[model samples]
Target: MLAKVLEEPERGEFFARREDEAHSLVNLLQAILDYASLSPSLKRRFTSALIRLSSKSGRFPDCMVLEEVTRLGEDPVAAGSFGEVWKGSFYSEVIAMKVLKVYERSNVKELLKRFSAEIIIWRQLSHPNLIPFYGVYYLNASKTRICLISPWMQNGNVVQYLRREPDIERSYLMLDIARGLEYLHSGKPGIVHGDLKGENILITSSRRACLTDFGLASARDSELIMSSSTPNARVTGTLRWQAPELLNYEAENTRSTFASDVYSFGCVGYEIYSGEIPFHEVKSDYYVMQSVTRGARPPRPPLSLCQTRGLDDTLWAILQSCWLKDAAARPTAEYLVSRLRAMPRNAEEKTTPAAHGWDRLTRSRLSHSLVDHPLSCSAKVVQEWKQLSLFEDWEA
Candidate 1:
């Protein structure tokens, strides 16, 4: 099958074949590349073969390369499963260049199909809460290094921005994220942001959060290169933020759902307010998975921290609702938007020092709580299963 794909020309009948297999094709390549048992020497051989074949798979014409794309940097500023994102310029204006990793090497037919499809879909997307897609251009004469362009966000991702400016109003940011999700979920065929971690949520210059790295299985079909030791680190980070259904092996399907995204939004909320990832207290990814599968959720922030960060009871409850064990029990993104719109002001009035003290007094009397206790510590980062290829065949 691989050889058959390789024999096709850039404009041949093969590149025009079935489009839906794009994500699956990418997954097949990922399975080979991420196979842990492959020795480094053997892996390098496979990479070389892919690289050699990449040049032949090029499809876009020279005219397609945007003249406005001024400069592309040598080193990538960020990396992920899709590819490397380099800091660049579009007609002298700063921009982000999303250089995809799969197109150059992975299967040519499905990738071009996926890229063409996503380009149209991404182009049609117009929302204040989404990072707008500019255009695509070839970075080199070989046409192997194609880039998807967008505005350069100086504020960085939501997590990085919050950590740098700890005093920023978190509720406002959360609302931005919620509105973005609402826009996506409100679409004709609601776009499920399969990945919704803080890293994928960029903070615009206006200080609003905008969603990126979505579509094409949340862009899992391409390699967005990362600086991590292995690509699996991205999946590991995802595991910490995943919905219970996505983590459950007993479940027939583990594909990300709208409900799973809501659960991840809850994790992102924890990151925004507490400056920590969900299950930060747990070191082992496997253990976090184990705990979540066993009905355990991330423990709440300390009372003092919660009060300081405006994570008042109302806001905490909203976040808790997003993490409901039953997917159907979780609130929709639209519901969250409405609730968050009035949350900050109401929470402020309700969480005054006096109110905090009063809550502290009464909270102890209530035996029940909104969230579960943190799982007891048992292990650190276990090297036994360094790479989890759980999402390779994840449903679209």
Candidate 2:
């Protein structure tokens, strides 16, 4: 009977619909496996069935495979370490398509399985502050390449939006991010936005800040990012927002934690208020890593600029707490949500003129052209680049 069960195809759809029942069944099966005094052969067969069932039980309830999508242009609108984002139309509605870059020699099946695990967590999430996952579809028949679909935010990321509309209420933007983090951290295992930065925080048409990339990459993907030989675009861009613990070469606990996410949150706060990347003064990525590990933090923006941006002393203090060297000393996401919510709106920011000497800060930093910035590319050029296997050396 167990052999027959193993031979049968997994009923993913059935388990997807009855998730509670699936979980209950899993629990019952686990209990039985633990206590039942079965013969060796029967026990082995029962374990195999349980393993197969367990894998199917986590399927997304409403998994979608979008069949039709029209690319808006040839060049990608944005690029990331793992993928390039193309502006596309899906069923007459504007959407963003994140085309994942998978090398020809890569283990496609293993990568897809890992990505599917992340999607299982991503699909069930629903919040105003979170970017909505439209669905995913293969870009190729072999399923070597895939595209993730999400709504296109015309307003762009929070940093770009704030740069254009400097007078926008920054505290409210911070509140949106804090709320998003709170919601993510409230989950059972708590989803960590492993790569949180200005670029990952999109501004919706409604002008609300929504988090985009969260737990999309597995540990193996992180190894590539940390590799010295990897593209500078992937490495240095994220290093600025990374926590000290994550950057410490000597530290054994290098994995991203809730504390690390909080640290990135503070960096994001700096970017939103200052209109500059964290540690912009440091010209080199190597130095930035060294500085962070040595307990250095981004310098406080000028008091006048802070006032204009509504970043008062209290808020600055909160940001500082997030950067504390001791990970345990950092504030929780829940605490941050409450603290940001209770912050009084600064009336001075509304009436104050845009702060001076801000452009100097931009000029001072070395150009980070490789960083994921909102840049347009010609469709033809991007198409030609896509065909080059050398350009696809790594996978996300």
lDDT of 1 at 135: 59
Q: Of the candidates shown, which would achieve the greatest TM-score relative to the real structure?
A: 2
Stretches of candidate 1 exceeding 4 Å from the true structure: 1-65, 102-110, 113-117, 215-237, 344-396
Model 2 scores a TM of: 0.68
Misplaced by over 4 Å in model 2 are 1-62, 215-237, 346-396
Q: Give per-residue CA lDDT, model 2, range 192-235, as digits (tens).
A: 66778999999877677888875332222221112111112123
* Candidate number achieving the greatest lDDT relative to the actual structure: 2
Give the worst 10-residue stretch by lDDT in candidate 2: 223-232
**Mind giving the per-residue lDDT tens digits that candidate 1 earns over 139-227?**
67765666787778888999889888988777877887898888877754345566788899988766778888753322111121111
> lDDT, candidate 2, residue 215?
37
